[model samples]
Target: MILLLSLSFKNTPQKIREYFAFGDEEKKRLLLALCNEEPIDEAAILVTCNRTEIYISTHIENTNTLISLILKNCEDIIGMDIEHVRDYILCYTKRGAVSHLYKVSAGLDSMLIGEDQILGQVKDTIEFARECNTAHLYLNTLFRDAVTQAKKIKTETLISKSGVSTATLALRVAKDELSGFEGKKLLIIGASGKIGNIVLKNALSYDFSHIYVTKRSHNIDMSPNVRDRISIIEYNDRYQYIKDADVIISATSGPHFTLTKEHIKDNWDTESKKIFVDLAVPCDIDERIGSLDGASYYNMDDMKKYAVENNEKKKLSIEKANEMVKEGVEKFLKWELFQENWKVFSDATKSLEKEIARIGEKKTLEHLFYKIRDNGSLEALQSLIDTLSN
Candidate 1:
């Protein structure tokens, strides 16, 4: 059976969700361990700023053990009982699991509905699992089907017509606050992240006076088109450059705040206008910074309010997308049933081939045609011939 454990901004508070945020290395390690030590046959984990979903195929009858194993592993990150963890996560099995994945890939389950980034993220997670050899036929087929349907939904519906996300919204807000990007100095902390990179690339479209980016541990790889436009700054020196930036955005996976009130006090000019956007789960900017004069602060909660409004606007498209997801789920379930019976088909085909060899192909065909002619229609004979040829 296919199983899914979803912990997202929809159900989990930022305090609890932050503990489940796994870095790339952690994800790889967890994938390896799940396949190696647990009863899980296949595993793929999707980690984003808003959700951490674990998809797995397993034959374990009692799923509680597997669920407990996962929560136990996170004890070092956050000490929570199984009951407490259960309060935040939603688990799905079989058909429900398949449907959930379709909605997720189609971006219907996202905080920002119809955001384009999620489909790519879903694709990347399955690809990573394939690379680790943790995903086999079951998960590979399921994810591929989900991705295909997601692309179809995007093409057929007006779900993503607005093309809005926290990244785009942050840029829009920055542009509005600063009049325009033409003369503004932009500083992006945690530029290596998914949303942060989106913000960086989107900001590059406009003509900023100068753009600065900082990374904590991961390397920020800039493409040829953007290399000349951005200046790489050390993460520790972020506060030093605060005085020069008109817009500051931070999106990181870490639990700690990147911009604390104390850190900004020395560098912040009280009279200068500065816009701060925090796109992280646990939040990268200090809430106290909003109290500072001439500082505009926006966090995930602020982003969510905008997302709700965006979702409201796309209600019709969302309903259409949900119907598509339902159809995709039914199709996937049918395919899954076929896969379950595939070995039986293979064995039957092998047996027929052996029988045909024993009787000689010509003789077998003649006998089958004679029998069909006597008892069945010409169409039955033709069907038998086609089946044999196959």
Candidate 2:
């Protein structure tokens, strides 16, 4: 039996979901932990700013027991109470689990419908699971099918035509707040990470006079076109550059705040308008900064209005995408059914082959044709033969 436990922005607030967000290493650890359990046969985890999904195949059919075990393990990893978040978890079994995954891969389940990032995230999650040896035949096939459908949806539909994401949305809001990025200085914290890198790449398209990125120890590899355009600042020096930045975006996997009110209180210039965006799941910026004069702070929850507006505009595309997802679900379910019955078909074929060897193929075919001609239709017999031959 396949089961899915999802804690996403759709049902859970960021305050709760943040506790479940795991970095790549932590995710791999959790995967190993789940796979270590006796009941869990195969498992894969998808962790994003918007959701944390655990897909598992188990021999145990009891949903409550499975959910409890999952929550307990998560608690052990992250130190959160299982009962505290039990109501927020969405559980799906068998077909529902498959359908949910397909929709999630297709971006239908995203906070910002038709966003382009979730597909890649799903792909990366499956790859990670495979690398950890936590994913086997069932999970691998499900993920592969989901990714294939997602690609087809993106190619055939205009759902992701704009290629919008949290990074782009943050930049858009910043541009709007500052009356455009021209003559502005931009700062990106945690620039070597995923969301930070996206913010860096998206910022390049704008007309900001200067762009600065913070790096801890890892070297940033920039494209030739933008290498000269960006300047690297040590992560420790981030506070010094904050006053000059018209737009500051902080996205990291760290547990603590990247920018706190105490650090910026004395440095911030109250006369100049500035935008502070935190795209991390646990949130990289302090909430109190929003109250600071001339400062507008935004976080993942703040992106909802923009996502809702985008979703409304793309209603038709979303409807079409959902239809495509439904079709994909049906096709995958049929394939799954075929896989389940394959052993039976193989055994029958082997038995038939043995019988043919005993009677001779010519004699067996003659007997079959005679029986078909007498009671069954010859056309049906020919179709069966053609199918078996294939």
Candidate 3:
């Protein structure tokens, strides 16, 4: 059985964050611990800002036991009762699991449909699993097929080209709100993540004069190409620049709010108009902060609404993507059936060959006697025997 277990922002995004807040080394340690406790064959974990999922390949027959094992592994990572999340968990087997993975890789399952970051995140997760020697043959083939299908869909369908993600849309909205970003000081919070990085890249593509990035760690160096246009700052000093900035974008993996009313109250006097785009799943900005004077906030759900509206124009492309998914599923099923049939045919052919050889040996001694008794007419006798065997 193949299982894809996900705990995301569905019921509570905080729970997902609490469970996966660890760094790469710690995550690897946790994975090893889980493997030790469970009957997992091949497993890969993908923990991101919005979701934490474990894709495992196993032969466990009891679904209840599998679910219990997963809960046990995650017991120490989350604050809530595992039973509370049990109802929301989704399970897939065989072809359904394959289809689900393909959809996820293609971003059809994303909150923001056609979001471009998921593909790379999926690739990274698969690569990490391979590096750790956790992925077996089944999962390796499954992930490789998913990645290939995703790329094909992206190139063949217009969904990715027609609809830009929330990050890029946020940049566009910022540009429009700030009037082409002329002489604007842009401040970006949580700059190391997928959405934050895309926002920074999109912002840089425009004419923004100055861009400042704030992250939890200050040890990492900024890219050389954008170092002139961007500056990195400590996470604690983020609010200081928020006050002076014309535009702000926040994409963090925190459980609670990163920007509160108290943080922005003091900054209201310095800026006439401030646009805050919160791309985080649970939202980094306090909802009430938008009520403050001279402040505007847009969260992920709002951006998703915009994306859905824009997707209407590209209905044909969506249809094409759906068709591609169907074709892929059909091809996989056909090949799988063919392999099963081929194995059956091979076994039957070997058995038939053994029976024919045994019969041939029995007839060899009889042939000489028949030839001697029938005045050396061995060719006619051989033909008769061959006909009877057939």
Compared with the true structure, what per-residue lDDT tens digits does model 2 show for residues 56-165?
98877999989888888898889756687888999999889999999999888887788888989999988999999999988899999999999999888888987788
Judge candidate 1 at residue 240 and give its lDDT: 96
Task: Look at candidate 3 and give me any clashing residue pairs.
Answer: none
lDDT for 290 in candidate 3 is: 78
Give the higher-lDDT candidate: 1 or 3. 1
Better of 2 and 3 by TM-score: 2
| Candidate 2 deviant stretches above 4 angstroms | 217-229, 350-390
TM-score of each model, paired residue for residue: 0.79, 0.88, 0.76
Best model per TM-score: 2
Q: What does candidate 1's lDDT look like per residue over 246-279, in tens digits?
A: 8999988776899999989999887789999988
**Cα deviation in Å at residue 197, candidate 1?**
2.9
Q: For candidate 1, what is the lDDT?
A: 0.85
Q: Which candidate gets the maximum lDDT versus the true structure?
A: 2
Query: Candidate 3 — which residues are off by over 4 angstroms?
Result: 8-26, 173-183, 207-209, 215-236, 252-260, 281-288, 331-390
Q: Give the candidates in order of TM-score, highest first.
A: 2, 1, 3
Q: Rank order by lDDT, top first? A: 2, 1, 3
Per-residue alpha-carbon lDDT of candidate 3 for residues 61-111, written as tens digits (9 for 90 to 100): 676777788777666655346676666666776678778788788877665
